[model samples]
Target: MRSLEIHGIDDLRVVDRDDPAPGPGEVQIAVEWGGICGSDLAYWRRGVSGTAVMSHPFVLGHEVSGRVSALGAGVSGPGVGSPVTVHPARTTGPLPERLRGRENLHPDLTYLGSAAGDPHTDGAFAQTITVRADQVVPLPAGLDTRRAVLAEPLGVAMHAVTRAGDLTGAHVLVSGCGPVGLLVVLAARDAGAARISAVDLSSPARERALALGADEALESAADMSEEITVAFEASGAPASLDGILRHIARASVVVQVGNLPPTPISVTLGPIVSQELEYRGTYRFASEIEDATRLLARTPRAEQVITHVLDLEDAHAAFTTAATDPASSKVVLRLS
Candidate 1:
């Protein structure tokens, strides 16, 4: 099988590797498509995603779709050749009272393509890869591999929206119009947000946000009214934080979904204290993936966010395009 592996910073390459077989309770999938996420580019560029250092050469994908090629001895239900999207997460330690219902908050968990720990969890960036059967989610009817590849990130967006609490008829603001931010717009609209506004430095990203669901997309908050009742900080840019705090209405909910670097930045904290605002932090996702699969199956327009699909042989090009092209949203790599 052909696999796209990252050896070090700026050293990603396509290498031939032996096919992996399913172990007990695991399933082997013939991957068809994988989305290029921001973290994936981080690994290619810096050999690390946050504190997750690249200890070894590993596959570089998590947002993937494939067909079940074989099942482990204990699993039997979703027979071979079934199309599926994977949840890509597994809890690895005893649950704590503080993290009972929120599994994604578990301190000890592993995700595909992440090098956050030693003997890092491998991901589905190959023509064939094996994963635990529990992570394999059979696709909902009419959801093809191409679009279903979005379920992972869409789940992240859904979870971020979940953190914002009820949006019923609430005016929402989303800063930064990256793929996840754009998906936040879609999810906010689905949650009955009265009006959705988005801000981004990139005009192309703003356009994509508007196409997804934002009532208006702005280059900045200069023209935005100070009426936003709920705000989501999805840009991860320090400057974007300043704008979000300046424009949101008094007593609004602000959910930070994007992963900011460990470094601290200076942002106006007066807004939070003076306006009596609520600021919440959100991580990856929990059980929202199931909902994401159903939503993707039901909404065809969601596929419009995928702007480019390149062949696996062009994996480097795919990463480059995903990182450099502001006009592109979700750039995917076709594996099989």
Candidate 2:
């Protein structure tokens, strides 16, 4: 089998590797479609940041959909040749904190494509990948592989929207018009948000956001109206962060779904204390992949989020395009 490995910063090589057999409780997926996530590009361009970095040569993909080629012992449910999307999360049952529905707070959680733990369980940027059977989410018939590849990122947006509480009839503002941010718009619209506004610096992305269900799109975050009751900060830009704080109505909820590096930025904490705003931090898909998948499957124009596709051999070109191209929303590697 051949796998694309990121040796270090800006170093990606397609190299030969041994085919992995499904271990007990695992399922091997013949990689069909691999979505190029922003994090993947970060790994390629900057090596590592936030929580994910390459310490050794390893595969780099998490948003994946494929057919079941083989199953490990004790794995049932979906048989071989079944089309499926995967929730690339690894966790040991429920921790004390997680048992209370706070699984994201698991004390010893490690993510796929991370430098920590076994770097051997390579990701889906290859001919095949073996994940825990439980991590796999078998999609129903008629879900195209290109659209199914978006399940992971959509899950992130779905979880963030649900966690941000009710948005029905609320004026919502989503900052950042990237894949996740655009998904946030879709989710918010599905949740019955009214007057949803998407903010981004890219004009083309703003247009895409409008098409995705944003009532209005703006290039300047500071120009956002002060009537926004919920502000989703998906752009890691410091200016966007400050703008969200200023634009959000009093007593509104501000969900930080974007992973922003620690930077010295000033904000008015007096409003948070006096007006009582909700500032929440959300991670990737955790316990809500199933719900997110259902939402994505039912949502109209879900496939429009995917803007480009390439063969597995063009993974390098896809990565480069994602890093430099704002017009490309979701880039997928079609393995089949």
Candidate 3:
């Protein structure tokens, strides 16, 4: 079997590895497409994402979809040949009261391709990878694998919208038009938002957002003259987050979906205090993978967001395209 490994910053290679067999309660998948996420780019460019730094070689992929090639003992649901997408986070430790129903908040969670652990957990970017059966979600009937690969990021967007509560007939603003930000636009539209506006420095991203469903696409939130009923911060920049806070209407909600750095950021809290604004932070996701799959099945335009695809052997070029190509939205690699 072949696996993509990131030995260090700007060091990625395709290496031979022993094929993994499924263990009890796990399933082996013939990995098909794996999307390169922003975090993956961060790791490739700097060997770190937020506070998590790579201390050893790591496999860098989490948004993946594939077909079941073999099943482990005691796994009964998804039979062989079933097409599926994976929920890459595995939680450990007892759940706290607030996190009991929300497993995404589990104090100790091990995520695939993450540097959070000392010995990084391998990710699904190989010819074949084994994962717990419980983490796999079957793709909807006839859903294209390319689009199905988006379920992970779409799930993140859905979870952000879920944190925003109901957006029905409300003006919504999405800061950052990256892959997740663009999907946030689609999610907001699907949730019955009256108007969907997006902000990003990339013209191509803003164009893509408009093509999907955004009513307006601005270069930055500072360009917006009107206040939004709800705002989604997906740029992970202090300036973008500050801009969103300035443009949101009083008593509105703001959901931070982007992964900000561990460092503290200074921002005005006068509006939040005086207006009684509701600010929330959203992590990976809870149970929105299924919803994201269903949403993708219904959204044909959503597929346009995938701008580039490459073979697994070209993983280095794939990472470069994803990290440097301003026109690229989602860059995926075909493993098999």
CA lDDT of each prediction against the hidden true structure: 0.88, 0.81, 0.90
Better of 1 and 3 by lDDT: 3
lDDT of 1 by residue, 1-336 (tens): 999988899888899999998999999999999999989999998887977889898888899998999999999858899999998888876879988779997887899999887887778889999888888888899898898999999999999999999999888989988889988888888888999999998888888888887899888865667778888899898778777887778888889988788777888889999989899999889888888888889888899889999999998888889888878889999999
TM-score for each of the candidates: 0.97, 0.94, 0.96
Question: What is candidate 2's lDDT per residue for 240-300, written digit by digit as tens?
Answer: 8877776667798999988887556666566677768889988775677777677777775
Worst 10 residues of 1 by lDDT: 218-227
**Candidate RMSDs in order:** 1.1, 1.9, 1.3
In candidate 3, what are the lDDT values of residues 35-153, reduced to their tens digit?
Answer: 99988999999888988899999787999998999999999979999899999999776889966668888888888899988889888888899988889999987687889999999
Q: What TM-score, to 2 decimals, does candidate 3 have? A: 0.96
Best by TM-score: 1
Between candidates 1 and 2, the one scoring higher on lDDT is 1
Better of 1 and 3 by TM-score: 1
The local lDDT score (0 to 100) that residue 55 gets in candidate 1 is 82
Error of 2 at 288 (Å): 1.7
Tell me the lDDT of model 2 at 216. 93
Supply every candidate's count of residue pairs whose N, Cα or C atoms clash at under 3 angstroms: 0, 0, 0
Rank the candidate models, highest TM-score first: 1, 3, 2
